[model samples]
Target: LKDALIGMDLVIIPAGVPHKHGLTKDDLFNINVGIVKTLCEAIAKCCPKAIVNVLSNPVNSTVLITAEVFKRVGTYDPKRLLGVTMLDVVRANMFVAEVLGVDLRYVDVPIIGGHVGITILPLLSQIKPPCSFTLKRSEYPSSTILTS
Candidate 1:
């Protein structure tokens, strides 16, 4: 890892294994934390300034773990350590584009709060191209919200 990380300006770590049967969410968090810690230590030693983009699952928590690791090594930079946990946003864009019959590239949907299917509130009112639609509560899950 050391040799490969030399002079790296950016590092995308898709660490940790998939959720398995019988393993709890807490268990997964612990396992992924350990993996991220080891990788962060290596980054601190090998390429302290490299921007680390964490792609691990349970990303919201893993991102905090990465911040702690970097803090310990005195290399913590909030801006440099990012969690690439935007799958929900991607899906949102896709669906919006499909419904609007526009190019996906032109669709931009901003989600707030929790992740998709969790508690995220997609600001559909702010979606690009600004299509008008009536969003009834029954149309989407309770987790999603619509605002004028």
Candidate 2:
């Protein structure tokens, strides 16, 4: 692992137990956290300067675990550790495009916050091409009602 990582500029950590039927994100934490800890240990030893993009499930927690591991090894760089939330953005783009009857390529929606269920927030007001959608109060809760 050390030999292969030498001089690498980017290391994307997507290793985790596969999400399947009956398995919640929380269910994955135990397995994925161990995997992330082991991999991060190798990364710290081999390429401490590499940019680490973690795509592991339960990312909100795994990211912190990675940071703790790095800090313990004296290689923590907050700026270099990133928790990828691109999946949420992609889903928002697809859903918005479907609703607006536009090509997916033309749709752009910025999804902020963590990558989990309610934590994934689509910035509807900032959507490209300027569109609006009506939602029932019961169906779509107000942003103020949702918590991280």
Candidate 3:
């Protein structure tokens, strides 16, 4: 890890088992959490100023854990830490665009909350063309706001 990270400007950690093969994000808490923590520790020691982008599962939880690890090493900077969920954003945009029958490029969605299926928040409230959509509640469900 040290050798790979030397002089690196950005460190993106998508380290974790995925929800494939029925392995849910929660199922990876033990191993993935430790991997994330250890990597963050090394990053704090080796490259204290690098931007750490964590693209792990259970983002809401892993992010907090990563922050805690950084704080423990006295290198905690909210600005330097980021959670990468581009896939989530893409998924939401595509889904919403399909629902609205518009070009996917024209659909913009802001997904918040957690990283799991139920925890994802799709901010559909503010969508393009100022349309209205009813949403069922779920765990940390995503909300989408249209920007058209």
lDDT (10s digit) by residue, model 1, range 15-109: 89877999987898899889988998999889999999998877777888888888998999988988875777787777777666799999898
lDDT of 2 by residue, 83-134 (tens): 9867667777767776677999988888778766676778889889698878
Pairs clashing within candidate 2 = none
Model 1 bad stretches (over 4 Å): 20-23, 97-106, 116-118, 141-148
User: What does candidate 2 score on TM?
Assistant: 0.85
> Lowest-lDDT window of 10 residues in candidate 2?
137-146
TM-score of each model, in listed order: 0.76, 0.85, 0.79
lDDT of 3 by residue, 44-84 (tens): 88888899999886667788999999898899999999987
Candidate 3: C-alpha RMSD to true structure equals 5.2
- Candidate ranking (TM-score, best to worst): 2, 3, 1
Instruction: Please identify which of the two predictions, 2 or 3, would achieve the higher TM-score against the true structure.
Output: 2
Go through the candidates in order and give each one's C-alpha lDDT.
0.79, 0.81, 0.76
Error of 3 at 123 (Å): 1.8
